[model samples]
Target: MLGAPLLEEASGIGALGIDLTSLLVYLINFTVLGLILYFMAYKRIIGMLDSRSERIRESLEEADRVRKESEEQQESMQKALDDGRQEGQRVLAEAREAAERYREQQAEQARAESEQIVSRAREEIKQERDAALESVRAEFAVLAVSAAEKIIKRSLDADAQQDLIDEVISESNAKQEQD
Candidate 1:
């Protein structure tokens, strides 16, 4: 009966077409092929991937550095523009102040010159008035002497004539003062 059960189990396995020896051999060959492929190409592929990743990291770092430098340059340019505008305004203000000063100086000089001209004209008029007064006085004296000579019809002594002329002149001056 034991041999009979063993024979029946073997017949069942044969009916299923399952062989232990063939399964074992297939497992061994698959393991060896996997190991060979890993040794031949796996390390080189991993190395290439690592190098590419490092290159990408370096490129990103360089781009960041360039962006920072560009920002700094923009700030510097803005500062320079602001300073130039302030300087231009200052220069314009100074120029305006200088022009105002020059105008004031010119006006003052013109006023001084005009005053001098008026003073000179006044002095000239005064001199002319004095000369005319002297001429009239001399003419009046000549007329008085001629009238006295004609009224008297006789030659008077020089001292007596001079006294008469002095009395007449003093009386006329007194009359003018009272009026």
Candidate 2:
């Protein structure tokens, strides 16, 4: 019995099928409140948040780009360093080989020069020996003729000189055979 008026009011509204004017007024109120909130609060707050988010996103993208570029640069520099080291090693090896070859060539040249010097010395000794032997032979001929004239106490005839030379040659040959 106490809920009769409230129930009747609810039933009366249901029977009338809803108040168009009140509905219109409520919609107008809600729309105005939404507009005010959007203009006064939501728009500003959301705009600040959006701008901050955009700045952060741009900064992150920039950081990523810089990081990628830096990594690429570092890799390139490392490759260059490796290449430089390889080139240096190759040059050093080539230089060492060249130096070794040069040293060997010099040693061979020195050896050839020594051989030439020894051969020239031997030839000089042979030439000197031949000259001395010729000089001695001439002296021996003169001495033998002078001694034959003194021993005989007079000049020898050609026939006598020939006989004397034959005897001297026979004596020299016998002495050489004995020695």
Candidate 3:
């Protein structure tokens, strides 16, 4: 009779296995709730962060492009300014050289004109001096002839008279030259 009751107690041992199955179902429910929360909250936050990062990257790229263009423009402008300054200096130097050449030419012309004027004045002075000396010689000869005619008390009478007057005039001229 004791062995027969012991076998019946052994059959009730399978009821403890049902408790483990119920614990497994509760673990599956907890895992599903955690996944739902992540999809609703954390996914939207990650999307917002990604869009903001893209905008910032594009803005930075545009700024870099603008800066590069500005530098290129400045370099070209600087080169143009330098070229203009060099051209201006070249023009100024050319102008100064031309001015100097013109001045030299003018000075040479003035000197030539002055020489011509002096030469003309000298020629005129020589001519006047010759005329004055000739006039004085003519007057002296007339006076000497008049004085001799008065002293002789006679008029010239042809060939003999001409011969005597020539001899006397030539001798007097010679003595005057010697003295």
- Compose the digit string of candidate 3's lDDT tens values, residues 10-111: 336653344565678778888887788679866877787888888888889989988999998898899998999999999999999999999999999999
RMSD over all Cα atoms, model 1: 7.7
Per-residue C-alpha lDDT of model 1 across residues 1-179, encoded as one tens digit per residue: 33343223554457554668878999998988878877877777787889989999988998998999999989999999999999999999999999999999999999999989998888988888767755665567668887879988987788987877777667656765687
- Note the clash tally of each candidate: 0, 0, 0
Off by over 4 Å in 3: 1-51, 139-179
Task: Give per-model CA RMSD.
Answer: 7.7, 6.9, 10.2
Largest lDDT belongs to which candidate? 2
Candidate 2's displacement at residue 150, Å, is 3.2
**Candidates' C-alpha lDDT:** 0.79, 0.84, 0.75
Candidate whose TM-score is highest: 2
Model 1's TM-score against the true structure: 0.54
Arrange candidates, best TM-score first: 2, 1, 3
TM-scores of all models? 0.54, 0.60, 0.53
Q: After superposition, how far is residue 119 of candidate 3 from its true place, in Å?
A: 1.9
